[model samples]
Target: METLSNLECFARAAATGSFSSAAKQLGLTPSAVSRNVAMLERNLAVRLFHRTTRKLTLTEAGERLADSIRSNLEGLQDAIAEASDQQQEPSGVLKVSMASVFGMDYVLPLLPGFLTAYPKIRIDWQLDNRHVDLVAEGYDAAIGRGSELTPGTISRTLARVRIVAVASPAYMKARRPPASPQDLAGLDLIDMRSTRTGRLVQWMLRDEHGNEAVSPVGERIIFDDPGGLCKAAALGLGAAFVATSHALPYLQRGELIQLLPDWSADGGPISIYYANRRYLPPKTRVFVDYVADAFRDQDLAGRF
Candidate 1:
């Protein structure tokens, strides 16, 4: 275990090019990183890093050692993680990221049941719409649109959501209800912009026969959040396209009315993503499976 820790310290230092950066990633201090590297060097009887006032550089031996141990070290860590997960009840902080609206509207409801099932597990949930680094930021899982997933992670589809055009009764009274996708071009538009790209989300409407229809958009008001877009539509600001999961409550409460029922856009897969499939923690494993089962039971799959 000591050897593995030392090797991990060395690998992190090498990858980040500094003890301070490595320390930050490892939740340790720079002195700890330096000490670990030194301890490893002493055990191996080799100088690993060339130290100077300005910068730290790896020696030839250090580079070779890094190249050799990086993969094996990661594999060993994964093995240890898998082994740890195999022991008893899942009991650790399961850090997760999720889109705000979906988390509150759907995932949040499952929490009470999940906690009842696995009392030992603790959840630290972060609500954000942007893509985050799962490894660097130290999140166990994230629930969001599949398109937001970064590389080096695996995702399971919870459901494919149908993006439907909706508006409040007042908004429709102000302007005629859109008869077809073509009429949408003349209506007041409440658009959702991607925070990552600052671009208006494109629409892909399909009719009952599964045919694509072009709806040229005019953005009278724009928001960077799905909830905000829905709220704007509810406030009778304009017609907005939102996921079924997000609009379900509003639709049920009669705060918003669906338009062009046969015409809808594919919201893509909403998935539960994790950094590693090879070593999923028991808490995360159970939560993902439970969520899938819940969705299936409620028949929310593909609709939500």
Candidate 2:
């Protein structure tokens, strides 16, 4: 019988198409990964991969075995997770991924309380704006903005985030505020490049009759970081459209003013997503519950 370690190495190498990448995924040295695959090949009396300096291609037999190994490993993982879920207190590293801004604004603040409540579990939180592959990256859970979730992931609505168009009071004093989404076209738009698609992001707004329209603005300053854009807007550089939560502090201090109250962009739902919901570790379950309860009363618009 092939050892589970050997099978894991072979499966990861085949899946990643590189021994080095597989090694990294498995937390093994590249040479160790190579040796494991070699052992598996010897045991099966077949070549598993055609390796060259730049790439690896799986053999026909290797491809077939890889599929079986992957399925079996996933099943075993699911079974182990199910067993672990039955424990009175979950104790394991819980990995979470989220956008940088949301993690900083909402999730990070709650960590101390969560850690104190559940002392057994450890946390590895990653914050990045780019989309993450939860399964491939080995994340246990993710909190993301927007409605669309990655396929095969379980999603729950954490909150509904509202977006608002805002400009510093100083900027509004120099230029008239945009009365409607359409008026945004003529303004000096401070564009967060990370959020902008192509030339601009469509500002979705609804009128009194519930008619919706998207207005694209001309970009005056394209900033990659949301914080930088917020700062620039606060300094009266240009008008900015940001999630209401992000602009809340500035609004309270009177550094920025909402441009158009009646017209605003709809941010879909702020959601907490996981690869699987059934048999979740107690720590993850408790944390999710805590976040849901914490934000329950506060309207999404007031969360920032």
TM-score of each: 0.85, 0.85
How does candidate 1 score on lDDT? Answer: 0.83
Give the number of colliding residue pairs in candidate 1: 0
Mind sharing the TM-score for model 2? 0.85
Write one digit per residue (lDDT tens) for candidate 2, span 5-89: 8988888788778888788777799999999999999988999899899989998998888877776776776678778677678
Task: Give the per-residue lDDT digits (tens) of candidate 1, residues 1-304.
Answer: 3477688889888876788878866778999989999998998899999999778889999999988986687788778878877775877788888999888878898899999989999889998898776765657788888555565577888888888999998888767778898888788888888877888887889998988985566767988999998898999988888888888888989999999999998878888888655667688788878888998887767457
**Residue 303, candidate 1: alpha-carbon lDDT:** 51
Off by over 4 Å in 1: 12-27, 38-67
Q: RMSD, each candidate, Å?
A: 3.4, 2.9
Model 2 regions lying over 4 Å from their true place? 195-199, 281-286, 297-304
